[model samples]
Target: MHLPIELDRDRAEPLQNQLYEQLRGLIIARRLKSNSRLVATRFLAEKLGISRTTVLLAYERLISEGYLETRPAVGTFVCAVLPDLVPAPQINDNRVDDLPQTELRPPLFQSRMPVGEPVEPALIDFWGGPDFRIFPLKIWQRITQHVLECYGKGISRPPPSAGIDPLRGAIADWLAAQRGIIVDRDQIIIVAGAQQAYNIAARLFLQRGDRVVIETPGHAGASFLFESLGATQHPVPVDEHGLLVDALPDGSTSLAYVTPSHQNPIGGTLPLERREALIEWARGAGAYLIEDDCDGDFRYRGMGPPSLKSLDPYGLVLYTGTFSKTLGAGLRLGYMVVPQELVASTVAVKTLLDNGSPWLEQMVLAEFIASGEYDRHLRRVRKTYLERRDCLIAALRLHFGDVQLAGVDTGTHLTWLLPASLPSAPAVQEAARQRGIGVYTVSESEIGGRPATLYTENALLLGYSSLEERQIRDGIAGLAAALRDHRRAATG
Candidate 1:
């Protein structure tokens, strides 16, 4: 049978890749049905004007990736267990004809913001937001088992709407001792993660058309949530120190979201003076500050500054902390220390949002923190991550010579400013990907929205926490080679 297979031999992509992509598209589009037989390699080669070896290699790759099946004695075919295709539903012509056509109303929110597609399994994911390789999984497993063994009977049922009391108490005590926020255990409301905590805060405070302040290049999740809730978001610019507090509007704002500890995307730590200024701004405007401390536990270079919530005398800050960075994103455990005045309202909102987080995980995490194991684990991983960060910086300098590194004083990743002679950030990212190395640029949504040319055009983000020291060096060398090649081609 003739199939719609085409190859571009002149393209940069390999012949095998072209063939694999065409066949995969056919299968996904359902042009090639499940269990349908594919033409023999020789037949396909002749039909497509490609060599038989190329066809054979492509077929082998497809089979290995689970898109095709090969029978020893018979032939190759589309996988029998492939998902069934659903045809598009038909629209009613008569109903459409009878309806009066009018101008459609503009949507209250902008069209959905495009998210970065998941990294292909074959590629190294240097863009993964948080490090998972160094997670204390063994220790966590032991703690989880201990919790189940000791508290199994109590957790068999659903936890209270406010979450397990002991876990809340542990979180409260931890915050008071570490974050300097004095709050009753009753004010601590546990949620799955900061995402859920944000949702709860939105529900409690935001109304349609309410104005909210967000960093210009802020967390996409927070931006999307505010947009989804019909709130108008005003983008506030961020500088080397952190958010520009002076840029905030003077009037009332329903909510202000800031990543004070380690700002997302840029990794700037908000200075103590800036933190105080932010608090004053929030108080004067009578707005709530949603402090997203997603990476508060991984401060490396210097003594970390105290949390903004700790200095908040007016109970204006809704302090949110997550274990996603310190522990793992999969754990999905985080807590918010609500001010005494907002406790009842926050709990009511939490109750409405999925009742509460799972009891078992919360219990186990609480026990982990209580036993002091969490602190020890942080100390161990922090050292390793700090070393990796330094290795990445040193390798970049050795290869590229005097590269400007930003956000290196803290956090799991740092941004390198490419020289004008090199290719742009996106160009560098794509070139590295071709060599099986993952390097991110500021323009990519993975780092947030298209960063201004000043911030993104000449910058690349290298996340070294998850990669080994050797891998880090190799990846940098690969990137340097790719950049050199690009420059040569451009001049030629």
Candidate 2:
């Protein structure tokens, strides 16, 4: 009789091993009764379309393992009893209620970010990601080739948990010149991305029942991270000028995460006056601040205010930024400039978290920054993004009468408030999506619980960094048509 066995040629596992495991599992499950006669090797091989020798090897392993016995004159047969080491599997009735009732503890919170299969991209996706066309691939390729030649052995070895010297130094120098922040190279720790940096910071600073102040309608990623750590989150509202410093509650808070340079979703930059006030608040409360300058590298307007970290005097701000926005997110490269006091703990935590970021990426990025190629590239990309931004603004005006936009002066994304004539932001997003255009509602982007205010209700976010001028215009036109169709359908 042909055994109920299946084999795959494409899997990395050897065919003989797969066959052996299946046969052993079947025998242990008692699917093949004790002392059942087995098929001839030649017949089994012909039926399975594998070599006769492959079947023989599987049979030999089974026999050696006490799952099978071979009669000298006859074909192989199942053993009457399994070895002491290979106990027979206890067969169950396949009834759900009969299964043991064990304690099933679910996670405290569900992740807001999308998981599993990635959401399908729109025909003209406005989701914020780097424009691959503008990426300096040739320069990177040359640097990568050079690194491979020079540091072939380095690839085999693990890098320091804190990071390599060259990359840390390069980042320190760049921050000094660009953001006006003076930090030591030793204080910088390379991390997988901004998310990982946030994780490291949370681990270092937060504990159960600790209080965290998060910007409402802010970054979902940060909100989720803080909450997952069992920290009690106190959400502060944001306005046209970013987080409301005057509205900050008077109390003790362990940590606060802010995107000051270009406030996410709403697109407001924290002004210098408020920045000073925020620093003072942190000092009074003795809370640490995490500055996530995720897209600070690309600024259209000339020189926004100095970073919150640059203005910080108490060394309470842990400044974090990522090359994902400028380079590519797939690289998963980011850095955190730690304070003098926290450097040791940061390094320890980083070492505990997967040893360290990869070596080759850090090396290539160091070369790119030190060689001044990174600066040159940013200048070119900034100019291109400005043109795209302008193109999107014009298209919006042309399609819909003069629209109100925010956070347009900086960052890759901008926010739009739906007009009185148009449907709600979520409705608009759905209409645009149906027409193969991607747009996001503000609530969709924010994490911590929504406050009573309707800041997120009528607002939509549009990311134009990845789209070209033509695509932006086309996308807006399509969006307009979709909205019109939605209105028509509602009226009918």
Candidate 3:
């Protein structure tokens, strides 16, 4: 069979290395199917004008790595049992009946606020969190490989319901030194991510028909999870400081979800006074506060704000954090620092949820943090993200002229309050999409509660961390042109 293979003989790298890299890329990207047959070495070499020996060597390396295999007489084929090439699981129709009858009934679809529209491929994605380019890939790769080698034996065994002990220990030490919260490792429950952590928290805390206080225009994931679990959501307004403690509904609020370090969507950091007041209110109301510190690692300007858990003398807070934002979302490693009284119930719920997170990732992350690589990595990315944030602010000001911005003091992204004369946030977002630039509105996120005019009309959320400086400038330029064209058409 003819193969789409190209070789650069003039390049400094060996032809074999190039062949291996290309093949690896195809396999990783899932372009090459499992058990697919390959062209003979002779035919491949002839096609690429390379020596047959080079092609043979590349095939041999791939075979050794379990990415390819050869049958003595059947010829060469991609490995059907490649570690990373598992077939997609077929959905079982019978599983639908396994859920309870009440849950089987379709939920009443109560429409809530709109979320940020997804960025199209043709558009620059500046709406997601974190700068992927600045993630410590090299360091993380080393740690991952090292952990696999050193902890392979342990990881191969079934992980405990509580999670990897060393990882929980590492997290405990991290919290003590970084956030000033002292707790036993047993109190920590490792989960897939913050959303899963919220699920567990809701399961443990919320009863049906219970009232839950959520930050207005907060992280959509938490709000949705609470509602899914049958908690009647009470929207608490957030101003320049943070969630309005006075705005919380009177009576028993089972759970209060907040992003106190850097409020999601708006990026307002709750001050110490407000933090104290909120905690006091929680104590009086007998409520549980779920503090999501998803982007707390990238505080750009001030001294680190104290986490809500740090100030909780009565054990009213459940702290949720994830490496997805700091490292990458692919890691799927996060933990919930539960109150001592609730730890047992939380762990039980975690066990029933998914057993526990993958053992290797937790071990590697533990070593990464304990060896101080994690802190160093955070420092590097924090500086890079801060610079990118500044560049985005500069670009917006240069193009749009005197834009009002918020949430830039901390977190990976900030909100730009669009001038009334230009266009609405959603309209500008749609216009930007036509010009291949991604922008967002609060309604596009995991927001609950009734639609307020302020959320839909004024604010455009721009995540600057993910894009390169030139990409940021170019994207904004594209958006400016789109807006101009829009205005021209409107006037005409």
TM-scores of the models, in the order given: 0.76, 0.82, 0.76
Could you tell which candidate, 2 or 3, scores higher by TM-score? 2
In model 1, which runs have C-alpha deviations exceeding 4 angstroms? 1-117, 121-124, 128-131, 444-453
Residues 247-300, model 3: lDDT tens digits = 877788888999888888788898888899999999988998999985788887
**lDDT: worst 10-residue window of model 1:** 444-453
TM-score of 3: 0.76
Clashing pairs in 1: none
* Ten contiguous residues minimizing lDDT sum, candidate 2: 109-118
| Deviation of model 1 at 277, angstroms | 1.1
- Candidate 3 whole-model C-alpha lDDT, 0 to 1: 0.83
* Model 2 per-residue lDDT tens digits across residues 263-286: 876888899999999999999998
Ranking by lDDT: 2, 3, 1
The candidate that wins on TM-score is: 2
The per-model lDDT (C-alpha) reads 0.81, 0.87, 0.83
